[model samples]
Target: MSSPPVSAPPALEVTGLSHSFGRRKALDDVGFTIPQGRFTVLLGQNGAGKTTLFNLVTRLYSNRSGSIEIMGVDLRARPTVALAKLGVVFQLRTVDLDLSVKQNLLYHAGLHGLSRVQAQARIQAELDRLSLAERANDKVRQLSGGQVRRVEIARALLHKPRLLLLDEPTVGLDIGSRQTIVDHVRQLCATDGLGVLWATHLIDEVRADDAVILLHQGRVLAAGDGATLCAKAEVKDLGQAFTKLTEARAA
Candidate 1:
């Protein structure tokens, strides 16, 4: 007998998501689905509502008008269940400089209600995977900017979330550091079947195969892989295509 094929559920899904601050609309009918084991880039310029969308996904703000599903669990109907399947890294630096690298991570683990043994096991595993186990005892302030970012990533993965979201994660990193972080995340997606939704405005970050959601002026201008977007825009590459897309929105 021939076996039936089964597909994995989307890591993250949103439909008709909209948000506003009084008269200022931040996200307007934003919607997309990120498939399991793929890297999906949310490409947008500054003030393009990337942060707003992240806020909604992390439940920092309410999604009053639309639906969000994390691993097939509705965020509104079961926030805890949905959030359990998700991990997030925001744009701002969040590690406590005064604390040791592991200390910062331990605090978060405690808040998540992970017992000492479980938290330590997960922390060590993630740090080792990131090649950061040796520095666990080091103060966060002593590490370089890039190292801190790596530590934050380790913390996010400690609970083994199915979907990972990073918003402008390399904002202040040097060119080399930026590339390193991007490459590392991409490797995770490929090697571990980790689903990643990375939000950034840097056009260079978009690869031909990775899916992209181009956001502009609080709305989605295009959604597809980099190659498709460039083909649709009739441009030479993602850089030119992104410029064309955003310019159209501005005008």
Candidate 2:
């Protein structure tokens, strides 16, 4: 008889994750797995501890109470190896406005230990991928808000991390720009086999087929495919389902 195939570990996993500041709990035993090659939306409102979760995963805040793993590597035990498989676009913009787009990406590439020739090649490829090739030499201050966001995405991907974490990536853009970013990231998950954890409060961004984790305050209220959550809530759409879930939690 042939041996059974081994399953791949999840792209990202958090188990029994908890955090607190003083007496206020920020996260309470949160746990979820982001499967490889899929888009998972961390759906929540403001103050929902989404950023806290991101902080723990990215090691911005020390994970005092729970475990985080990347590609089956424990984050605390193997920081460098675990972080090597992760990329992040934080909620706040981090690119330098004074530098050209290419310069910004090159600086990021260097931080990841890429030499000049390697950085240049990867930068060009990502610029082309994001349709920002024409803007490569332009100062970041000259780019529009959406273009700046794209630049951040390009910078994050310089190392080709397997898992991408985007925190409220579309918060400040116009609807057209928001949709463009959303569609592009979804395409990455589909075509490039990149696992994504997209944190957002915008209900419209939740699609029926996408994995959805509904978080309120510091806890996960529900988690499943969007279609399943809506069906369970007896609602017509994700928006209504979200409303129902949050309201019940509040009550």
The best candidate by lDDT is 2
RMSD to native, candidate 2? 2.9
Flag regions of model 2 displaced more than 4 Å.
1-6
What tens-digit string does per-residue lDDT give for candidate 2 at 184-241? Answer: 9998888767889999999999888999998999999999999888987899889999
| C-alpha lDDT score of every prediction, in listed order | 0.89, 0.92
TM-score, prediction 1 = 0.95
Q: Can you give the lDDT of residue 63 in candidate 2?
A: 92
TM-score of structure candidate 2: 0.96
Weakest lDDT window of 10 consecutive positions for candidate 1: 1-10
List, in order, the clash count of every candidate structure: 0, 0
lDDT of 1 by residue, 52-153 (tens): 999998899979999999988999889998888888888999889999999999998987778999999999998898788999999999999999999989
TM-score, each model? 0.95, 0.96
Weakest 10 consecutive residues of candidate 2 by summed lDDT: 1-10
